[model samples]
Target: MADQLIDSEIIQRITKKKKQLDSIRPLSKSALQKLKERFAVEWTYNSNAIEGNTLTLNETRLVIERGLTVKGKSLREHFEATNHKTAIECLEGLARIKEPLTEENVKKMHAIILRSINDTEAGIYRNVRVRILGAVFTPPDPVKISRLISELFKWLNSAKMHPVELAALAHYKLVRIHPFSDGNGRVSRLLMNLILMRCGFPPAVVLNTDRKKYYDRLKKADRGNESPFADLMAQAVERSLDLYLEALEPVKPGEEKELIPLRDAAKGMPYSPDYLSLLARQGKLGAIKISRNWVISKDDLKKYVEKKKSKS
Candidate 1:
């Protein structure tokens, strides 16, 4: 089952990329801090947005950093952004210590995520039976949650696997447990990145635009096909690794890293923008999604071409 959940090609690619990034360890503090700020915003905005938050990425930034309330958003949306930011901070603190993921840690994050939004339900498992809106599998009854979570930790502690695979499956297991009444997805993702960050990978931001596919992949895992969900999370970790490598690597003045949408990135290339988009979505190309548009640097495009040619 772990083999089915570990797409070898994607997992190998992620392992290779992470090793490449690790070679340049001890990055400058400024560069690291800048990436932290950027990713924190992207991470908070996209995670909340997947759950139907109305704030735009920039609006989320304003709420977290500038503390400015946006014109048209609800107070709950504002709290979601700020609370996620706080939870990220707390998560980072936990990452610094190499402790096993525990029930207390999970509850702490759930509490931060639901703070001010659902005070009564924050950090607490649901007493009432619940149903996911579009899920294929029913969540276990309220009484089963605590035992299931404990069992998950037992498996997590003893399972032998790569960190990326471990992180993604850990996410799936938590979602399967549906431990909390609210904030389950948010807490799952937070736990996902906590696993990754503890293992030295940057936080993987699952884009809001990828929400449909994201849920679809999870549902596939629910049906006992874990490969798609594993690939999805592997691609996310790969994307984050690419981001950290790009930001931490220095460039000459005349050769600054430039990110253009796939349309512009495809010019003079043999691949069409659609082809490139497919590659990007499949994690074969190093690209970033800006809002709904996928963008890549000229250098990365070149690398993709070179890598493909070599494989051929």
Candidate 2:
């Protein structure tokens, strides 16, 4: 089916990069620390913003890094940033040991997400029925939440799909169950990335700018069209992989052709990364593949630009 094909394709791409990453296994401690810190800020900001938290990205960083409260933000907003960072730390620890996803783990993460914001609802399933604003689908009854969640974990354990697909599907499944009174979205995303990181992949961050599209994909999954959502998660994973691989790649000496990812190759150009990728795939821009990732030399990109200008 469509889902199957997407899953296979994404798995192949991830598998290829994972192999290359393994060749550079055991990234330097400082590099790992730097990447984690950056992602913590970005992930915390985006996740909280999608949930309508008022802290700006910079404010979230200041609050988390400096422990200094924002002038106009509520106490809850500060707590959200701090708590999410704590949850991310927990996630990093779990990933180090290759921890399996479990209900208790989910609860622990949800608890951190809601700590000081809603203590009563933290880490606990709701006892009352509720409606998600603007959502077309209705969650199951509160009485059925435990059973539904148990079933989801069962599926997660037994499913043989790619990690990207499994992560996306798990996220949608949790969202549909709406097991918690609050923090379901944040918890679901945390759980999704937990699976991805455990599978030796980077965390897939759903940016705040894609909030509308994020919900729209969930809607599609709710309507029995899960492929688009899977594809979206795959792209997110690809971006994270791109980031890690680019940072970890060694700098080559001299004018000798040093191949870099399209993202790096497109720097200083008007073209977006996606556009550069498209051109590469279309053969308009000369690029080579390193384990399914597009890599182009600076000279190649310059030549391509010159060729395009000549055409114009």
Candidate 3:
């Protein structure tokens, strides 16, 4: 009961924050474009990395941006990054139409994920039964894969659960089914974000740093526990919402100043991010807190530098 109450509280908080975010709808075009690009690289890197892709985040960005391959990474790694980007674009199209989740849509995405890598298995159901290493649950039989997927889509359409819960459940159920020969995890994550995007939430990235927790939560869900997985999804959505809301905060006309993160503000300056953060924390810099990060205006950094020069 205590855990249930806590989960309820968290759901309420997520809903409240989501509502606040929706109130600021239609984020400025530039900010929206930047957020989309940023999330695309991040989502691709983390999703592929969680599956053991060796490309660093910077390397992933380079491949996506410059179409340049890294020297040390495998060809498959590069394809994974590009393929996942294509999958995100496909998700965006579905979200625009508010399309209901379907097995065909899922297969289309799985095909994109495996494109140029495994032509035969791409977008097709598995004929051989396989086990997810380290998972507590085994996926359904090969013969039942289509049926299970159809049932999942049916439930998704009729279920009236909260959007976060629905997204988590969609991911969890797909993983349980493991319908495809490969790319199941990647496709499942795509489906999760598809549900979220259609429901007006930003894509919730399950960071590679949290790979262990992510797997553990899925395992817990396998054991008939949904709280951990649901909590994880809610937190992911909330983090994205906070980021979007912060980036999209409108500027007032009379204000001649704006705030930027310490790292961005420190660019081309002698000060490093850590040094700037220290100054902000010490109140020696004209900076303000937004969420857990500190932001400073260009003018404020200039003033701080001038004041230091005079003292010297």
RMSD of each: 2.4, 6.1, 9.0
**Best-fitting candidate, measured by TM-score?**
1
Candidate 3 has a TM-score of 0.79
For all candidates in order, the CA lDDT equals 0.86, 0.81, 0.82
Q: Which stretches of candidate 1 lie over 4 Å from their true place?
A: 1-4, 252-259, 297-300, 303-312
User: In candidate 3, what are the lDDT values of residues 1-312, reduced to their tens digit?
Assistant: 233511664566567658867887766889899999999998999999999999988899999978998997888899999999999998999998855768889999999999999999999999999999898688889999878888999999998778888888899899899998789899999999999999999998887876898898889888999878877777677667756766786645653246688889899988888988887654456455544577766756786788788989
Model 1 TM-score is 0.92
The estimated TM-scores of all candidates read: 0.92, 0.81, 0.79
Cα lDDT tens digits, model 1, 1-312, are 345566666666678768878887888899999999999999999999999998988899999999999998899999999999999999999999976778889999999999999999999988988778799698899899989999988888778888888889999999888988778999999999999999999999888888999989988998898878888888788778767877886665765356778888899999888888888877667677767788777877887788779999
Best by lDDT: 1
Writing each residue's lDDT as its tens digit, candidate 2 over 52-167 gives: 99898889999888899989789988999999999998997887784456788899999999998889888999999988878889899999988898899889988887777889
Candidate 3 global lDDT? 0.82
